[model samples]
Target: MNKHNAEYYISKLGLLPHPEGGYYKRTFQSEEQTSDQELSVEFEGKRRLYTSIYFLLGSDDVSHFHRLKSDELWYYHAGSPLTVHVIDEHGVYKEYKLGIDLENGEVPQVLVPKNSIFGSSVKDEDTFSLVGCMVSPGFEFQDFELFTQDELLAKYPQHQDIIMKLAYDLIPV
Candidate 1:
């Protein structure tokens, strides 16, 4: 078992609460913006070209199913393995394990495509995972959408098990 608990790391890293669940702190934001003229219609307005955050998930916490308009990259930092669950727009479900165990097929980083519903949790119940997330076209509140259980189930009935497992609202927060 890990020597440190979630509270220890939270205090050490000065992380704040994240809307999608878990604790996080914005680590970087680019000053450069994607000009309105150059941005796609999906984007509401101009946004910084990049942004990143230090994300942490305790054994009791789960990053809920949510979708962003911009692509996101996840980098594993420490602790137990994290399982990132993704359900693409076409209803395809996939899971990516983030950890240092390359021999066991765990990858240190993963890219979640834009508009794909995604969530994460520590694979080991006794441990926590610290990670960094980078978003391109920078993150904007207008580009984020939290999933409702009903909406997700209706769209992807085949992935019911995972949907129920990862949807934030379905579980105690």
Candidate 2:
């Protein structure tokens, strides 16, 4: 076994600024793929934080907004039609759609900061994407917060009463 210090490896993992939050760093890249049906790595672990990968079914509205104690990176592997949205600390939100001004080269990626919210939507069928979250204090499944429409409406009724800025597309499954 290759014994390595977790802290050392964490530093080597390369953390970068998340587009949504300022409290975390994230890095996302693609891996060699021999087939369209290959399993992808969603998350990687090193020291202070780990990574997460996700698979979005085509046309399925996937909730993206989430706040983590760490940073997150999203890498688009297969499937051309995809949309990602994020809300910054200032409550400024932006949505990105793939295939629009999309360059033909490395897979596109998105960075999400700690304590920020973000979400994604898949337009093509049979789509796969990878997400990497680097938690400064590491991550625990218990810390995962999956929000629902009713719950969000109940919690932040003031925000919901406004203009319905957030659209409910998917329920936790």
Maximum-lDDT candidate: 1
Best by TM-score: 1
TM-score of candidate 1 relative to the true fold: 0.93
After superposition, candidate 1 runs with Cα above 4 Å error: 1-3, 170-173
Q: What are the per-residue Cα lDDT tens digits for candidate 1 across 1-173?
A: 22467778788889998888889998899999887679764676789999999999988878889999889999999889999999988889999999999999999999999989999989998779999999998998788889877889989999988888777545443
Task: Give the clashing residue pairs of candidate 1, or none.
Answer: none
